[model samples]
Target: MPKIDVNKVAEILKKNELEPTLLRRVMDELRLAVQPDPGEEEKPPPIKKQFVILVSDPEQKLPKDDFVGWVLQIPEEDNVGTTPERVCRAAYDFNDTKKGSLLPVSTIGETLENVPAKHFKEYNTWVKTRTPVLVVRTDNQIPKEVVETEHF
Candidate 1:
């Protein structure tokens, strides 16, 4: 990934065309997590449900983090079974980019919870121990986070 820079962060926000206010909050959090000054109290990276999405598919026999994985967390839910689908979908969608990326939803244990248990079966978690990965196989244009969370 590019070196941590406010300029890069701003560029990302601009390129993605995100809301300035929300992007600012997320950027501030990223700074705290990725660019904490030394000797300052090291805080636990913001923990909600950060996903370590591997850019390379596991089946492709690629090394870990070989491409461009994104580390993100699921937002809090107001009710049970209401995990932050935005972050989940974001990470899951990223993981689904390649059949070999993570478990392709066709291979994960059926009893596992939190992981994508919808249509398709070959998918599973990249890590043997990971659960709730939210992987998907859809190739259609990605939907907006709001739509994904609500209608997905």
Candidate 2:
């Protein structure tokens, strides 16, 4: 392979209207995209899309009839109030017309069996705040003011 000068590449990118910082980022991404073994086939990048709704617990100020299901991060049994906190999603039976449904408290390890470890890690990070749970509303249940047609 021919040795290419990084500064020259940056200059060419700048001439083509890409900013230096953007050029660096693009180069970094290219480095990450390169496969180590030349014989290996390139794979498509994983699609990163999710419908995450942030809301307080349904038992609180929010009206109970609005949501379909809730997302929760069940903390570890022994490490209740600690940092680098781990989490798992608790199941909810939406069909049960019961008010104030129970949220199970299983260890984070249990979720690994169901959810991919990569995604669970992201969910765990998202739910670290005081109200980490996500209330997934039904298709038409979200308030009109919060809905934007352009983003959908």
Candidate 3:
């Protein structure tokens, strides 16, 4: 077995446009030098892609006359080959009408590709104020003669 630094060997191969078999030989030798174990099969690297549009509850503000629906796209490779269609969920606001069509709240724990469409009504933290109560009492034992105090 020969000792070779993988990075140095790679640079040499790249600089000379040499065949990789020499580099592979050094790598295999280096692997064997450490533990001298059976060769294990190499695993394929996972594919990385990008996600597109993700809808939040505030953006779905559509006109009262129309109905709305949403859809999402998930890469089949990442989903373990499951061909599931992206679905957007919308619930009625029920604020303007008595239809009770209010939609459910939409939360994003992860990416939009995994979350289904969700409808959410608005939320308000509004509160009202009230005046304190006051009472005036007249005692029954008051004197018959009324004495008026002078206002200085």
Q: Compute each candidate's TM-score over C-alphas.
A: 0.22, 0.19, 0.17
- lDDT for predicted candidate 1 compared with the true structure: 0.46
Tens-place lDDT per residue, model 1, 29-144, is: 87777765788886788857545443424354554333332222222343423333333443455456663265433322322333443311323212233344433232345556
Q: Poorest 10 consecutive residues of model 1 by lDDT?
A: 119-128
CA RMSD of each candidate after superposition: 22.8, 18.1, 26.4
Ranking by TM-score: 1, 2, 3
Candidate 3 lDDT at 46 equals: 83
What RMSD does model 3 have? Answer: 26.4
lDDT for each residue of candidate 3 in 78-134, tens digit (9 for 90 to 100): 452331112112222322334322433243212122222332212211111111112
- TM-score: the better of candidates 1 and 3: 1
lDDT of each: 0.46, 0.47, 0.38
